[model samples]
Target: MRIRFDNTWIADSEQAILLHEPGHYPVAYLPIEHVEEGVLLPTDRITTHRDLGATRWFTVAGPGRRGERAAWTHTDLPEHASVLAGHVAFAWRAMDGFYEEDERILGHAADNYHRVDIRSSSRHLVVRAAGTTIADTTSPVVLYESGFAPHWYVPRTDVDETALTATQTSTFCPCKGIAGYYSVAGIPDAAWFYRDAFPEAARIDDLVSFEPDKIDVFLDGKQLGVEPGQTVIAHGLDRGLQPDEIAHRDDSGLHNTEGQQ
Candidate 1:
């Protein structure tokens, strides 16, 4: 993995270690040797993780760039956590972490839990909001994700596209590329779908699924409430660059919004 911020390559390593914290996606850890010199400035801020001992933060800076509290390292670790010693990891959303010249992922780092197995289903699914049927699909794809409830993805044909107003809200799932949202009536971002799903999740391409918590989802004749692991959480650009920290450059010349070449 390679990390870049403000147009400078700060770190690159073949020894990138992927750490998957429960309830979150995986994060890459690179050996201190792989990081460029004079980039990580120790900060007073310190935090701790459950397994990784006392952690310290750093304001990472590189050629024309500065990310405040953007990097962290586990300073005092238990002996078993020796592998994490002298290694630092950056937040995926805080900085641009790429796998190669064009392989970059956003939101959270990819994890094994990212994979979703899809199977076709004949059971009828109806999505209702504001007393109107937004979708009535007899042909739905059953998506089984590791920690999420089994989702019913209704084909566009069975959905009342007119009732779905596209919203600015979008999220990136490592295995699912970018997901878009749609609003129903007054409900904001009540539905989400993978307009262009990654190859691993191609089965759900263009199929919209309603958030059980945001709207009423019915299977056959029973209502479905929020599932145990269904989260409507949104990912933010957690860290921001300081103005005058770097000159404005044309991002189009080097990277696309999707990082897909």
Candidate 2:
């Protein structure tokens, strides 16, 4: 893993630890020794991590750019969290970019537990809105991702394109890339599609998925509905996310009942 800022490499480490706490996205913590010399300047700002204890902040400096309180480390870690004692974590939005090898990683640190599986299904899938059949297809792509409900994506050829009105709303998924929305029968953001997804999720590229709560979706003659508590609020650049950080973001889908740090 490597971090870049101000067109300079700030940190590069092959032994970085990924912390996956509840609610929040995975965060990468690298050894302080792997960070470039003089790039981290300690700051007086200090915060507390519920489990990790006292957290010290640092200003990340590179060339002519500086991110105030952009880096942090837990100074008084609990015994069980000792593995992160000598590690430092950078704020996702504060840096220019994070990379694995030559490819750039977006949204947040990739969660080892997170998985995206795409499968082609022959089951009949149908979508209706305002008493009109907007989409009907026998060949649909099923997208199963970690911690989310399965989304059925239909090819454009099977959809009634005229019934879809493009909307300005857009959301970004670290794994799937940017998702543009469409309104159906005057319903706002009732459908979404990924025109240019990340390489790993390319199978669903240019495919459309509808919101079950906003429209009537049926699969194999059975009405489809999202399970309770499965709906997620979209996270996008409007939330002050940087371009690189915009690639992946923490959505409200994950529950943070334990108040993890």
Candidate 3:
């Protein structure tokens, strides 16, 4: 389900309202400040759930105060008879446990995924290296899928390593929480993460290696190929499931169900 905040703490240049969730019913959770005065007609359906979940609904309208009737216009919430309003507080007084910091105010924790898509029609590169492919577009553009001098992630069994001269360089990603590096002879500038193996990126554990670059890239050729300046769609893989629940493979050879792979 989708949830949005009306009076977000974002900078003025940014939208004070944020659009969250694209699945299920979109729930609108506006900050108290975002609700215009007189428009909020509070409700009293306060009930506690066995799981400790609680919520309240409010009726909202506009023709607001002081010549301002559309305080919520900036947000995507539709104008209706009223709006829901209530603050949820949780206290796990069951066991000998209690949340002193009130994690409830943090709203629902979002399930984040690292999904990316690579595509380019200029040289049909994206389509060429669609299977078992990985590319990195960190800062300066480097094509890891292709055996280039700049050394990046390439298929473990694909790349021609005669040009590889492993260096001591390494880096990290806050998202996947993985770190590694690489280099080539006399070039001392190539880097590789893992080929079909990652202790951290179990989601993309099959990715051999990829070059991090400013612009996206694509690779094509031999065991390792080069199709620079292309985009690759990446995502996490799910764990165990029954045969009937298994996902189908796509033209890219990546198994995906719904919009996720």
Candidate 4:
């Protein structure tokens, strides 16, 4: 993984390690040698990773941009986890972004266990929020993603536009493009649709999916229960960063061994 801040390459390495922290999802880590000089300033803040003990924080500065406690390093760890001895991982949301080769890695470093499979379903699907029908369709598209509920995507035509109120809040999925928001009469962000989905997820092009927690979703008259691993966990990196969060850092030359080695 290669990280850039303020347009300056903070670190680039083929040895970057992708870690799955208990509370946090996928996080990218690179060896200290891969980091640029003066980029990481040791900080006072410390955190404890569920598995990795005694994690230390740092202030990563790039050009005029400085992130308080933006990066962390596991200062002490068991011998089995010594591979991360001299490694540092930045907060995906705090840093500008990540990349593999020249392509950007959205959300976080890719997780082998995480995947999205979109399938066409012919079963009758119904969405309701606060006793008001949100959407009903027989041509629903089912998005089966690892660790999430089977999201039933209904065609825009079958949805009742009168019951949906548009909201400005939007989120991005690395698998899907920007997801637009919709609110029901008494619910907040009850539904969401990807107006312009990424090519990989074009199947759900203009279909909308209701949050099962906020609204009731049924398939063929059966109420859909939350899957074993379904969750509403916060994906901070998925929320697009504000312009004020970006800063450039270009200074002393720091070389990297970046290709897949």
Candidate 5:
């Protein structure tokens, strides 16, 4: 893995540790020795981790840029967490990019436990909003993702195009590229589709999925509803994400599912 910031490579390591915490994405912690010389400048700021102990902050410096308090290390780790003693984790959003070899990793570090599976199904699925039929299909693809309910995606040909209006909203997923939103039947962001998903999620490309809470969705004659606490907030500037970095669409049209399981 490699970290780039300020148009410079700050760190690269082949033995980075991926630390998973509750209710959060995994973080990549690289050995302190792998980081470029003079890139991490110690700061007076300090914080504490519930399990890892006292954390020391640092200002990450590059050729002509500096990210204040963008890197951290556990100074007083518990005996059980001693493996992280000589490592530091850079604030993911603070860095320009994190890469596995030449391919860039978006959203966050790839979680080993997170999985996305796509399966073709012939289940009848229908979507409705404002008393108008938005989509209907029997050839839907079901996407089963870790920690999320199954999402049935329908081909655009089977959807009522007049009911959908492209919206200005966009979201990024590390496992499944970027998702573009659409307003359906006057409901804002009631539907979404991945025009150009990453390799792992290429099967549902250009397929639309409606929001269960904002619209009526039915699968196999059974009405579908949003699972408790299943709403996902879009990643935006507040999370330090910029459009140019994560919203670039791929036009290769490859449906390879060989990466990021």
Candidate 6:
């Protein structure tokens, strides 16, 4: 997925760019910018590949060099068999083995409830499914701000952990962070996390778990409340609500919710 060029960047750019390295298995390069400008010297050379043909090459200039020397051919290319390792640069990869249309239709009518909450204490907005509660040093345990949907962080000691057990699955979120998993035996995706957390989100360090969107999210046998519509960034320092480009809808089109039925 990703590879680092110990030290190199494209000519004069300040950002350390990661370009898609094409091949059998695509790899990327992250050269130090300063090094590229001062030391990368082009050579009058070109190589061909059996699968993709006409690969280019370059050389680094020595300290006292006027030009360049020493070429290391680019190896490790992508091929049909190479897909197994997936993308190294990608933190996680979906292995559904189907195109967008096929994958989307696989679970088209799946029922799930998505909930988002902004903490009053931290003001950090967390997207989570309704009904799940996190535990920690608080009365009602908090939830972790992890998963595909955001959920606010709640302390762990405040939750009832009797209904959960650790699971083998794991996931990474660039926004929130990596998560450890827990699940209810008969339920799918009722995974809860603990142990690791997003750095600034200390509030949920050891106190969160999620109820499957398909299940009723509850607290100590009590049902957690749900909203009839999508949550909007009503009031905050960020000012206007998010989804800036889209209009708001009432309870129906946004996400589903659960209550004591």
Q: How far does residue 237 in candidate 2 sit from its true spot (Å)? A: 14
lDDT by residue for model 6 over 1-261, one digit each (tens)?
111122211222222222222211112222333233534445666666455344444554433332223222333455542332211111011111111221111111111222223343433222223344333322433443212333434444444556566766665432234566665444555655545444444455665655435445444444444333332222111121122111221223213111100
Q: Comparing 4 and 6 by TM-score, which wins?
A: 4
Residues 1-261 of candidate 3: C-alpha lDDT, one tens digit per residue = 111122111111111222233331112233554333554454554443222234333333423212111112121223331232222111111111111122111111222332322222222122112232223222222222222243333344444455455666544332233344445333334345533222334434323344333212354422344446443222111111121221232223122222321
Off by over 4 Å in 4: 44-50, 128-134, 227-229, 232-261
Worst 10 residues of 3 by lDDT: 90-99
| True lDDT of residue 137, candidate 6 | 28
Query: What C-alpha lDDT do the candidate models reach, one value each?
Result: 0.74, 0.81, 0.29, 0.75, 0.81, 0.34
Encode model 1's per-residue lDDT on 1-261: one tens digit a residue: 677766667888888887765555566789999999998999998887778879899898866667888888999989987888899987555565445444654444455456678999999899888889999988999988777788889999999999999998876565566678998877899998987576778999999999888999999989988766555343223322222111222223245422221
Q: Count the backbone clashes (under 3 Å) in each candidate.
A: 0, 1, 36, 3, 0, 43
Stretch of 10 with least lDDT, candidate 5: 252-261
Write out the backbone clash pairs for model 2: 107-248
What TM-score do all the candidates reach, one by one?
Answer: 0.78, 0.88, 0.26, 0.79, 0.89, 0.36
Candidate 5 stretches greater than 4 Å from native: 231-244, 248-261
**Clash pairs of candidate 1?**
none
* Predicted structure 6: lDDT: 0.34
- lDDT per residue (tens digit) for residues 1-261 in model 4: 788776678898999877665544676779999999999999887877667899899899988779887888998888878888899988777766677776666655677777889999889998887787878899999998877767889998999889989987777676776788888766889889987576678999888888877789888998886666554355433333332222231112123212210
Candidate closer to the true structure by lDDT (higher is better), 5 or 6: 5
Looking at candidate 3, what is the lDDT of residue 19?
A: 26
Candidate 4 global CA lDDT score: 0.75
Candidate 1 least-lDDT 10 residues? 240-249
Error of 4 at 195 (Å): 1.8
Give per-residue CA lDDT, model 2, range 126-159, as digits (tens): 9998789999999999999877889999999999
Cα deviation in Å at residue 173, candidate 1? 2.9
lDDT-superior candidate, 4 or 5: 5
